[model samples]
Structures are given as C-alpha cells and as structure tokens.
Target chain A: MSKNEETEKSDVKDSTAAFEEALAKTKDKKYVLHLYVAGMGPKSIQAIDNIKRIFDEYLPGKYQLEVIDIYQNPVFAREGQIVAAPTLIKELPPPLRKLIGSMSDTERVLLGMDLISKPNENDEKQQE
Target chain B: MIEEKDRTLKEKSLEKAPTGINGLDDITYGGLPKGRTTLVYGSAGSGKTLMAMEFLVKGAQKYGEPGVFMAFEETAEDLAENFASLGFDLDGMESRDRLLVDHVHIDKSEIEETGEYDLEGLFIRLGLAIDSIGAKRVALDTLEVLFSGFQNEAILRSELRRLFRWLKDRGVTAIVTGERGEASLTRYGLEEYVADCVILLDNRMEEQISTRRLRIIKYRGSKHGTNEYPFLIEEDGISVLPITSLSLEHEVSTERISTGISRLDTMLGGQGYYRGTTVLVSGTAGTGKTSFAAQFCKAACERGERCLYFAFEESPDQITRNMKSIGIKLQPYLDSGLMQIHASRPMAYGLEMHLMGMRKILDTFNPDVIVIDPITNLISAGTEIDVKLMLTRLIDYLKLKNITAICTSLVQRESTEGINAQEISSLMDTWINLRFFESNNERNRGISVVKARGMAHSNQIREYMLTNHGIEIRDVYLGPSGGLLMGSSRDIQEAKETAEIAAQSKNAARRKRELESKLKSLDAQITALNSEFEVQKEELDKLSSEEALRSNALAKDRSEMARIRRADLH
Candidate 1:
C-alpha cells in the first residue's frame, strides 16, 4: 500500500475508535444507589462503611454511589423510601436492586449488584 | 421534562397508610387513601389534638407505619408528656425511629413570604422527617396556630390549599387539625373544602351534665355514622359509644331475683323480677320509696351480686344510717366491695354532667344491679323533657349492657291518683305504689303491686310496717267492724277493745245458764202434785158410784113397786 493511503486508513481507524469510545461512555451503565440510615448513629456509620467497601471491590471502575443519611438529609432518605438502617440501592443497573443490612456478605452483595454469577458446585469441584 | 415523568411515576408508586380508629376508618372507609389529607375541625378542648396524636401514635405502633407529628400549639416535650398520661410512649417511639415529633415554632412576625415561593421549604422539612424513618402517616396538629400568624385570609387560604396539595402529592396520609371558626370550620374555610374528610368533636353540657360527642361532617367517597356518638376521655384515650339502632332482637334474661320482701316477691308472680329489667317505684313522700329501693339493693348484695346505689336525695352515710333502721345494713356490703354508694345532689352539676359522671362511675364499677333513689331529684337540674330524655338514654344504655336497674320517683300526694310520671311508666318493667291511708282515725302505709311485666302480681293492697327489726307486710284483716284502722298501733288498739267487750258478754251468758237450770227443777215439782190430785178425783168418783148403787137399789125397790103399779095402770 502507499504510505499516504496507509496514513489515511490509520486515521480513519483512530476516528472510529474515538467514536466508539464516545458511544461506550454515553451508554456506560450508571450506578444508581440508595443509602438508608436511621438518623445519625454509629450503626449508620457501619452501614455506610460496608457499602463503600463493597462498591470499591466489585464496582471500582464504573459506579456512582449516593450517600443518604436519614438525619442530616432526611428528604432524600424519604424520597428513596428507606425504612430500615443501612439499606443500599443500585440504580445504575437496568433493573434496580437493593441490599439491606450491613453489606457483610460479599457473595450476596455481588449477586445483588449483578456483578458475578452464582457459583456452581461443579466449578468448585473441578478447581479442587 | 424529567421532573414531569418523575412526578407521574411517583403518583403511580404511592401506597396508602391505614389509621386504626373505628368510626373514623368507617367514614374514610379504608383510611385516607394512603397519602391524602384529612381535616379535623373542632372548638377548644374538643379532642382535636388528642385525636391527631392518637392517629399518629396508632399508625406507628399498630400498622408498622412510621409517623411524623408536627405540633404548633404544644412543644415536642409537652406533647409527649400529654400523650404519656394517656399511655402513649411518644418518646420511646421517637427513639425507635418509628415516630418523629417536630414542634414548629412559627412566629408569624418572622416569616415573610411575599411572592410565589414554593412551600418546598416546609415540604422539605416534612419530607426530611418522613424520609428519615420512611413514615407513612403525618399529623399537623392545629393549622389554626400557623394561620393566626398571617393577617390576610387569601394568603392563608392559598397557602393551606398548597400545603394540602403538597401532602397529597407526596402520597402520605396526613391529618390536619384546625381550631373551629365562629361561622365556618376554619377561619380560612379552605381546609374543609380541600380535605378529603372532616370530623367535628363537641364538648357540651346539658343541665350541667357534660358529654363529649363526635360527629363526621363530611366524607367524600365513603359512608359514615352521621349521628353524634357520646365519647369519653380518660387515662386510656377517647372512646365513643355509638348508639346502635334500637331493634327488638336484644337478648332477654328470664332469671328472677328477689325483691328482698317475701310478700312483695309473692306479689311479683312468686319470683322477684326478671333479669335486666328496670323497676320504677313511685309514690308520695314518706311512703317507703327509698326503703323499697334499699331493700332491692340489700337483696342484690345478699345474692353475691354487686349493686350500685346512686342517691340524688340522700348522702351515702345518711342512706346507710336510714337503711340500718329498716334492718338493712349496707355499710358492710360497701366494705366488702359488693356494694357501692354514689350520692350526689341534683343541682350539684348540670344534668348531662351528672349523666357523664354516672356513666364514668358505672364503667369503672360495672355492677350487676343499679339503684337510683328518687330519680325525680334529677329533674331539679333539667326540664321535665330533659329528664325524660336523659332517663331514656340511660335506660337504653343500661339495657344494652344487660344490667338490672331500679329507679325510684317521688310523686305528689295528689298526683298518685293518676299516672305519677307518665313519661317513664311505659319504659319501666315494673311499677310499685306506696301510699298513706287513714282508717279508724289512724294513719297507715299500704303497698300495692300496680303492674309487673311478664309476671302475675297480686292485685290486693297489703299493709306494711316499718319497725326497728325490718319491714313487715301483714295479711288482709277481714273484720265485721264498720271502720278499719290503718296503722299497726291503731289496729292493735282496736283488737284489744273488741276483745274486752266480748269477754264481758261471755261472763253474763254463763250466769244466765245457771238460773235457767234452777227454774226447770221447780216446774217438775208442780207437775207431780197435779198428777196426785187427778188420781184422788178418780177414786172419789168410784166411791160415789157405789153409794149411788145402794141408793139406786133402794130407789129401784121403791121404783119397782111404783113401776108395777104404773105398768098395771099402762
């Protein structure tokens, strides 16, 4: 191929990659979140901590988390319809999901967030 | 554009909250449709605050629906304390995050809303509180306090409408309490029209008797109890006794109880009275009306049944002492918890207040038999019609509970000839008459069984005596004498006099019988002499015949000679 033709083709490829990146960014899954706390208390702190840990672990690259304190920001807590302490809402996913209690169960949290598929006994047996 | 979609989506997603008040729920049917606003309007001390707090507390505790209470009249602490007396643990609920109590101290002078400002500020605060606990119920206790801060009715009216709209938009069941206006429900007159339901509470006194009544003025999409139901507020909260339509299907008890007097019981068809019956004993003054009622109470207590004696004429101590003279000791029964003596003057308070007091005491005591001595005294507090209506309501109430009630009425001396109190006679299960009669120049008391429902009672009037021992009913005394004495003492005197006269006449007859026996002996002697004289005459005649025979023989000889001569001649 001619050197000029090669350069143009490369340029076209670059433009196409840039367009695709833009499209991907536009269509990137949002992290719709809900935080439920019962007023300002230590238990609320623990719930926020556990949710932050889970978000960092499974959705580090692409996720937006909204912190909802029922006491200081009760309006959002009511709007999100939080009834109990330490409730998490995942809104970014096509279908919204909720995780109640302190997000201690990593597998359950990941499953609730649709980050990982449920593990199978056969896969574990093969690994063993 | 996004806000519009969000708004539609929110409207579609909201769910209704349930309030557990009985009649109130019936009016609103399934409760204020989850997130709608209901206005409760009433005058001062009309139970608006208490009702609002009750709704909020009930929602949080009963239905797992958290609630927010915003009070403009009372401070948060004061409201909590007031509810605490009613056994509502507002502080505990607050601690559990199930309830939020906010005392919005609105100084009308400080607030300045000149232009169109979104009540979002107030909505945001309410939303924050509701969102904090996901409260499903909200109560704004007394909007009038806030409206009072504003001068212009137009501004207040529009603001109230917007507030109600905002609450409806949020899909939260809200109760707005308001102070009653002189002419309308609220001074602004906007809440009654805008709200989905309106309830009016009234505290009124008739003839000095005070009663709390509740009424539902308007409900949009549901049917409700339209009558004003009597309610009471105590330590437990508010209770409304909805008057059920009178039907003849109420259960009747055939059990009989003694009237404490055997003769009286015999007059009542060999049984005292039917259970759950009302007996009215009416008569002139000093005719043993109170004694008869006391006897009933005594009999009831003896049967191990509790009795409540409401004496409007006499005090408890005086009644107890008076009953003691008639051989009925009520003090021991009172001490044993089997009898309660409630004594209050007729004019001590208004008639409705008295009724309320009686109702309160009845509820607390729950007696099997209730005795009101001299119900006529209650008339002093109200008009004749008021007394009749009050008694009617009281009778209906007591009958509904299946309680045996006895009411005594005092009739004027002359009025006893006619219906003593015609208004109450038809309602009474039994009527007993006690009267004063004069016989043989003496005063006496007579008791007659006039009428007893479902029982055959004696028609003859019986004499009764009140002695230190007890009331003694005597039998009918049939005497040949023209006049009869009524009092026991006079009857005893007449019997003595009649006995003395009969004893003297019997003695004179005994003497006459002795004289007659002597006369018969003398007459027998005279008859014997006459028989001897006759025998003598017969013997003389015989002698005369012999002599005559001799003479005749002689005469015959002579005559024969003469006859021979005569024969020869013939």
Candidate 2:
C-alpha cells in the first residue's frame, strides 16, 4: 500500500509540471496582428483576403485572423490601421504587430509579425 | 408601505441645476432646484425669449447638459436665424445632439377645449425630443401663446399645473416663458402661483429710450438676488448683470484724472476730479455741456488712458466732426484705438436695456473715463423717478469700480430756475452750471462752478468762447458792469471817464474857495480905509483947533487937506 501511494504522488507531480509549462507559454507568447488594405473601396476586399491567405500560409495552424472592411468602417481607415484588402492576425503569438499596403512585401510582413530575424546583407539584396 | 420609523429614517436629498452665467450663480446661491419649473414673465420685447434661450444654450455648452427648446410663438428655424446675429450657434449644438429644438404651432382660431383633456400631446413631444438627445434642460418659449388658442382658462390653468408637476416628475429643469399681465406679474396669475421660481422682465421707454429690467420675484428653497438686474441682447448673446451688493468695503483710489481744461482743473483743487468721481455738467441748452464732456474724453485719450464716449443724441460721425471743428482732434485717438465712440438714440431701446448695454461696453472696454453726453436724453425713456434711480445705480456702479464718470444734463432755462428741476444735480461730486446771458445786445456763454466737493473753486463766472481752436475761457471779465459783453476794453473806458469827471469837480471847488477869500479880503480893506479916513479927520480937526488961529484956514481944510487929500477925495 505504501508503494502504491508513492507512485500516485509521482504521477501527480508530472501532471503539475505539465500544467505549469502550459501556463508559462501562455504568459510569454502574446498574440500579434496586422490588417492591410489598398483604399476604403472594395478593391481592398482581397487585401483582407490576402491576409487570410498569409494566415493560411504560416500561422493558419494556431492563429486567429479578422477581416475588416475600411469602407464600411471609415473611422479605422485613415490611420493605416488597414492598408491592403487582406490582413492576418497571429493572435497566438506574443506582442501584437501590423503590416500595411499590399501583402507583396512578405518578408517585411514576416519581419513585422516577428516570424523572422533581422535580415542579413544577402536577404536585403534579395529583397531589393 | 413604510411605517413611521422607516419614514423617519429616510434621507431627504435635493438636487440643483446650475445656470452658467457669471455672477448670477452666486446670486442664486447654488442654482434653481432640479426638475422644478420656473416662470419667466415679461412685457413685450423684454428679452424673455432671449433670456430663456441663453439659459438653455449656456447649460448645454458650458455645463455639458443637453437642452430641449419648445417654441410656441416662433418656428425653430426662425428662432435660430434670429439669434444667429447674437453668435448663438444653435445649429452646431443641434448637430452634435447636445440640443433639441421643437416648434409648436398653435392656431388661435381653431382651438377648442371641453371637459378635461390631458396635455399629454405636448408631454409626448417633449418626451420624445428629450429622450432622443437625453436633454437635461427644457424651455417652453411662451406658454401664453398656447392660451391664446384656447379660451378656457380653467382648463389651461389645470393643464399648466399638470405641466409643471409633470416636468418635476421628469426630473429635468424647465423654464416656462409667459407674458406679463396688464396689472399682474403674469397674464395668468395661476402660473406665477404654481411656479417654484418666478422672474419678471419689464421693457419700458421713458423719453423715447427703451430699457429692459429683470427681477426675480420668488425663488423657493434658494437665496436669490432681490434687486432688478439689467440685461442686454447683443452680438455675443444675452448677458444679465446682477446688481452688485452694496458694500462699504470697496477701496477708493486717490488718483485723479484731468478735466481737459487747465483752469477747470485748477478750480477742482489744483489737480482734477478724483478717480471714480461722478462729475455732473448741468445747464440750459447751448451751454456746451456735451463739448465739455468730450474735452475730458479727448484729454484722457491723449494721455494714453482709454476713453468711451456714449452720445445719446448725436451720431458718432456727427460728434467726431463737431469735435474736429472744435479742434479736439479725436481722429488720431480713434485711429490709435484709444478712444471709442458709441452713439445711439435714447429712444432706440428701453432705459434698462441702454443701461445694460452701457454696462457691457464698460466691462469689455474697461475704459478709464466714461462720458455720457447729455444723460438727460435718457429721461425721454423713463419717468423722472426711474431716471433718478437708474442714474443713482449707475453712479454707484461707477464708484464701486473707481472709474471716473462724466454725465451731462440738458436743463431748460425755466427748469433750471424752477424749484423742481428735472436734472440730476444732487448726485454729483462736482456740479458745473452753464448758462447763456444777453448783454450788450449780444448772446454770451457763461460757466460757473456751482460746487466742488473737497475743494475750493473760483466763485467767479467765466465767459467761454467757442472758437475754431477749441473753447477759450477768457479771464473772469471783472468789469464794473455786470454784463458779460463788457469786456476789458469797456472797463478801461469806464475808468478813464470817472477820472475826467473827478478833475472837473476839483477845479470847480478851487474856484469857489478863491472867490470866498477874495470877498473877505475886500471887506477888510474897506474897513481899514474907513478907519484911516476917520483918524485922518480927527487929526485934521485937532490941527485945525490948534491952528484955529491959523486957520480956519485950512479952510478947512476944506480941504483939510482937502482933506487932504481929498479926504480926499473925495
């Protein structure tokens, strides 16, 4: 009976460690988001579409993406809160961020999203 | 239902709504009780509508409380346009949802009331408007207009009571505008009795000048200013100036301001009138009273002290030209913004309104000297007593501010000499009387310093000449003759004539003395001659006796020397 109680105590300690690790991850990694649009018109439609595409590109596995129509919501349109039709929100990642205009600037978007490190000389040359 | 113990334990709380007007809030302690109805009753053109609208707009703009205005006399658009000149941006406020304006059209010809009909229609409209914008202030622009449409006073009275009670129940401050009755505070005395607060506005014209006065007759559960307040409707909206409480603690200034004329200043204690002193220049017409006041304003402007000229009779341009003719040179001062001329006919408005406008200008300009050219013009706008009270209040106000004030009064010859004069001469610290006298078949202007408080003034009357170069006050023409036209030349001529007459008299007296002395000497000479003759005769006789012998001879001389000599003579 004493041996059985010791095994139960060890199982309890493992489960507690796993629970603490999950809590630590949630506390450290903050959700990051970005919305882009061309203008207040419907052509900016696919900008949100493209952002959802990017969300499907890398962050689709575990992130949340929101589509905003700047024309209908003009209050958020002028500030570049949205620059392109498609925008992505990496809600699962830490420290929120944004990318504006066309999603063609993917590396910049990735950099803005903190998905990549500071670009090297070669990366800069490639971007140019 | 609560029992007696529960009722005793309940807390009594009262809410107050503030009227965002300067000095008015202090007069009303805190403000009118919230959710209570206030009746603002006034005669025609007494600024009732203006006052009510101002209260609502001020509440909405200054206190962040939305307001609802219901007008029965004028449409909302017309009302807005009317107030546009007064700088009230009602449209902007309405766009911001801070104010709601509802116009109710009541046709007097078609309205009929029977039995008990609820005023629920008005309530519903007001409620909808208030609810739409969450208004905290409400104004019914003229409840009397509603009464005109219906002849039933009993129904109207009950409806009004219900309206007040309903407003109170709604917990919103309301202002109900009403027309003043011919002999009562309000046309329907019922409104006055029902209102928690009652205000009366009066518009009267005396001597053709119009004035507006506001008085708070009753304020329940609050301390309010009891005296009548003066209000003005101008480009900047309506302003109500509560009368300043009379306090003896107001500080006095020892500073003095020049009276333009050096001789006049010298007569005023060698300095000038004391600061804040009310100087009165009173006289019959054509006394240059207005000119004297203008001279002071001109001097003040030249000294870099701002001055305001309030001309009730003359247009500003006319006054400027007149002053220029007198060599006053007010143009330069006006160009420099040192002098401001406000010209208006006293009959253009009511007396209280004029007073209010004067107060407002004084407040805005903060002038060092305020000159009212012939304040007597205001008499046309009010009764004698009203004018006196207004002048008294105005003088008191000026004294409180320590501003030098000059007021002129035009007195007719008969009035000035009459026992009951219409002029405000008693309230002046300095009274200067101007008069015209006929002398030498010519009209002459004379000014005399009647009284100067705290100073000794010349008792002599000075002759003033209005010339191209301004007023020239010649030396007191101290001629032997009383007429003003007896200039110095006349005095000299009189002196020379007297001297010649005295010389003639002296010569005549000398001649008389000479004649008398000559007579006396002649008489003595005669007596002496007689004595000599007698003595000679006696001697002759003696000699003759001695020479009787010899003589008879002398035959006596008949000669007795023939007599001798002729007694010679013979």
Candidate 3:
C-alpha cells in the first residue's frame, strides 16, 4: 500500500509540468484515479495490472492511481458508494466518471476515462 | 407478533422475526420466517422502498433488533430525508448504532464490464455493516439494480443466490426488493433466488382513484394470508389491513347499553344494544341519522365511558350545534374528553386511508363506544363492494376490542330500505331503520328495529320526532287500514277514534232516559184502576143503606138479625 501511495504522489508531481504547459488542452490534463476493490481477489489484481498496462502505454507518469481495498477500509467503500468491486473513479476530469468491473478492455476504459471521445455517429445509429 | 414468539418456540414450529408493522404480523400468522430472505416486488410508486425501510426501522426501534439497510438505488441521505416525514428517525437510529444505512451506487451509464467480477464489494460492505451493529435484520432494497450495473446475468444470479444463503446462514432476517415485471413478480426474477417468502404490492387506479394492495404470494413452510389485502401509506407509515373474514371467535358479553331514547330502548327488547356489538341506524335523508348516532354517543358519555364520534358529513361544531337543538348536550362530553369528535369529508381520501386513519384514532382514543354518523357518505370514497369490505374490517376490529359501534347510514330512497345498511346489515347485531312517512301533506319520521341478534325486539314502527327537548319516540298508531300512521295523519286518526267513542256513549245515555219514563206511566195506570174500584164499592154500599132505612122500624130488628145472620164473627 505504501509503495502504491509513493508512485501515486510521484506521478502527480511528474505530470505537473505538462499540466502547466497545456492548461487548456484535454490531452495533458493530470489524471487522479481511485480504484476500489475487495481485498486481494483475483479480479482486483487483474484490474490493477490491466489499468497499469494501459497507463504505461497511453500516458505514462501522467496519472495517479490509488487502489483501495474496501475490506480493509470499509469507510471508503461507503464514502465512495462502491457497490461493485474493481470500480475506477476518475476525479480530476471536468466531468467525473465511474467505471466498474475488470479493467481489461483498454478501449472502453479509455472511453470511460475521457481519454477518447464517444463516437457520436454510432450512438445516433443505435438511437435510430 | 410479540405475543406468539414463545408459542412458536414451544410448538417447535417455524420461528418468526416480527416486522412490527401494523396488521402485517397478524396476516403472516406471526411474521416472516426467521433468518430467511423475503422478496418484495412492486411497480414504481407502489411503496416497496417504504415497506422495506419500515421493516428495518420497526425491528430496530421496537424489537431491540439492530438492522442494516443496504439500499441499491437511493443514497442513505436520500432515504433518511425521504422517511423523515414518516416519523422515522433514520439518522438518529444510525447515530445510536441501532441502524446502518448503506447506499450502493450503481450507474449503468458509467460502467463497463470487460471480464469476470463478482459482487464481493457489496457483500463485504454488507457484512461490515452487519458486524458493526450486530444487526438481526437486513434490507437489500431493489438488489436487482446490480443487474443494470453488471453485464453478466449469470454472475449476478449466482451471486444473488449465494447472498441469500449467506444471509440465512448468518441467521439474520432480510428483505430483498425487486422491480415488478410484466411476466413475473420482478423484472430479473429475483423471487426465484430469494424464495423463502414473497410479497407483491400493487397500486391500481379505478375511476380515477388509486388504492394500494398487498398480497403474500408465498411463504415457504409457513401458513400465511394469501388474499390481496388493502394497505394504506398513512401519515406515519404503511398499515396493511388483514381484515378478511376473521373467525367468529370474539368474546361476547350479555351486557346491554341504552340507545338514549327511552322508547327506542323499548323498541330494542327494552334493554337496548348489546355491549361490543354493532348497531346500524339507517334512514332516508333528514330522518335524523346523525341525531340518532349523536344520542348514542351521548348515552355512552353519560355512562362515563369514552365515545368516539366519526362524522363523515358535518363538521364537529356543526354537529354539536345541530344536536344542541335536539337537547343533546355533546359539548360538555367533548370538553370533558370523554367524547372525541373526528369529522372529515369522506371524499378527501380513499376507503383504505380512511379506515387506517380511523384505526389510528381508535388505538389512541381506545373508546368504549364509537359513532360513525352518516357512514353512507363513505360510498363516495369507494365502490359498494369496497365500502362493505372496509366496514367489515372496521366492525371486526371493534368487536375484537369489545367496543360497541353505532353506525348511521342514509338511504337514498325511503322505499329501498338503506342499501348501504343492507350491504352490511348481516354484520350488525342490531339494525334500526328510520323512514319518512309522507301523509296528510306532511313528512314524519318513523323508527323501527329491523333486527337485533340475541334479543326479542319490538317489530313495531314508532313515530319519532326530533323535538326541541330530545328524540321523542311516540306510541305506534294504526290507521283504519292497519298501516302505520304518523304526524298530522296519526293525530287526525286518533281524534276521529275519540269522537266515535264519545258518540256511542251519548246514545247509550238517551236510551236509559226513555226506559225510565215508560216505567213511570205504567205505575200511574195501575194506581188509577185501584181508585175506581174503591168508588164502585162505596156506591153499592149507599144503595143498600137507603133500602135499609125505608124498612127502618122493622129493620132495626131485621138489620141486627141480618147482621147476625150475615156473618158469624168467627
């Protein structure tokens, strides 16, 4: 847990430079993410690994991720209103978002994190 | 619920965890099966959330059993604020460690499920909450929300099954709610998973009026009420009415009470209505139904017993003022707190709501007798069948409490016999029917006892007037045609009867005088005959004397001789 906290603190500090340079752009915005899980379950580990791999490939050292084990810190579970394990909350973006389940699908995770915009034409087609 | 716990244990039968909800425990026989998960499903606005919350609240406050409310749709704060109006101190219960409210936020719009994930977080949170308060009751309101949050239906189903088992294994009674579906009790068929008990709530609209009904679809291994019972979402909380046909097991009393009208009492077997029995006073409009009911209440208050008056048409002040004209002093009883007058327009609420409101008042007032003035006005609240059902329940409740009930009903037509009273007359112990007699260009009121159980009551229809002094029940007057007469017609008939009797007596006196005069004339004729006979005898004697004088000289001797010869002095 301490190691995870150190990496989270360092990542925020490291992303501050790009945040200052590209203040108006959405690309270089510092991402603060909270991943709530239930103990050291297999899904929790897989979710952590999957999101880390995505962070390394897309915005390395530009995101801060803190994994919360709701079993150990149940208060956070209530405060966060977490119902499903492996829930990821993106707090830094203008519009907050919450994504649940294993973070294996990189495209959906990116879409959920506001790293990519939704395809509006597909949405309209579905509506039609 | 509290009364049957020891019995259930002694009988080695299914134990129950009482929900403490009004009328719910009674219908469930005891309560929901203990340490089991019961599913409650309903459509939106059908009061599923409120019912589930009440179970927890009541368990915590009344049963000394801490509860955990794990809401899947609403936030804890929202739930607390929502129920605050219902007098449920959710936040207070939480602060006092008697209750724990956990909201599991599920947003389908924000979730993406890529791989396998169990609902272990919800389980852990629930467990932690339970452990914190040692909760004996748990409420997972609308747990079906997990279906929307997760894409794996199979996983959700399996986890739900396992969650119910866990709840049972922990020996904590739990209530799981689901959204109603077109084909099943719930959209996701949650009833299939938590199948120990299932209750369905339905809100139906008929004639632009809405009524909430509850039904126990199944209670595994336990006997329960299977009929759809009308329930009300009252000011305080939900109250289910289990007022079906209860067994005829209520205790009976031989005690009788007065009807306030002495002659009316004479009409009711000369002893009035039996204690703890139902009396119905039915009549046409302006036949004094309200006055009859008020007199009953006055009589109760005079006995120093509490009375509750439910006036569906008139305001309390109006009734008090109107009754004052009839010389019934209701104000003193009201002031002394022996009588409570609750007046409301029947159309203001549904039948179930009115029943529940009356029930609440009944509990608080705990009166010995109750008067429902103009109960026919309640027909505006529901249909005839609904009104009948509502009154049945009310009467059953009153009987159980040994509370004598006098209900007044207004008949639409004088010839039809009060339809409202007729519908419920079978449940009443005594029925007093008042009708308007239209005769002599005037309308008069007549009261009669149509039926009184367990007593020989007068079947005669007596005319009653709402005099300034009070209700005066007059002697029954029979017309020449043997029909009941009233008002000016009765007075006219009585006067004519008296005149005929007087004429008969006068003719008898004239015959007696004529017979006396005939007897006096017959006596005078006999006296005259006697006098004439005496004169004849005197004349004969004078002739004989003259003859005798002519021959006097010789006759002196002859007379003596004749006298001697004529008669021997013997």
The best candidate in terms of DockQ: 3
Q: Individual DockQ of the candidates?
A: 0.02, 0.01, 0.48
For model 2, the interface Cα RMSD in angstroms equals: 28.6
**RMSD of every prediction:** 20.7, 23.2, 8.3
TM-scores of the candidates are 0.65, 0.60, 0.84
List native contact recovery per candidate, as a fraction of 1.
Answer: 0.04, 0.00, 0.72
Q: What ordering of candidates by lDDT runs from best to worst?
A: 3, 1, 2
What is residue B270's positional error in candidate 1, in angstroms? 2.4
**Could you give candidate 3's per-residue lDDT for residues B1-570 as a string of tens digits?**
866987778777678999898889989988888889998888899998999899999998889999999887888899999999999999999999999998777878777766667777788788889999999999988866766778888888888788889889988999988888889667767655466999989999877678899999999889888888888988789888887647679899999999988888888788888999998888878999888888888888999999999988889999999999999989999999999999998889898888888988999999999988777777788877777888888899899899999888777778634354537878888888888888778998888888889998997888999998789998778987999989988888888889989999999889888888888888888899889988998999988997788678685776678787996533
Runs of candidate 2 with Cα error greater than 4 angstroms are A1-128, B1-31, B42-47, B72-75, B103-128, B144-159, B179-189, B202-213, B223-232, B236-250, B313-327, B414-423, B437-443, B464-570
Give the TM-score (vs. native) of candidate 2: 0.60
lDDT of 3 by residue, A1-128 (tens): 99999999999988997787676566677789999999888899999999999988888888999999998998787778777788888888668888777888888888888777787998899999
After TM-score superposition, the amount by which residue B279's alpha carbon in candidate 1 deviates from its true location, in angstroms, is: 1.5
lDDT of 1 by residue, B263-329 (tens): 8899899988888989988878888888888888888998999999999988899999998987888
Model 2 CA lDDT for position B54: 82
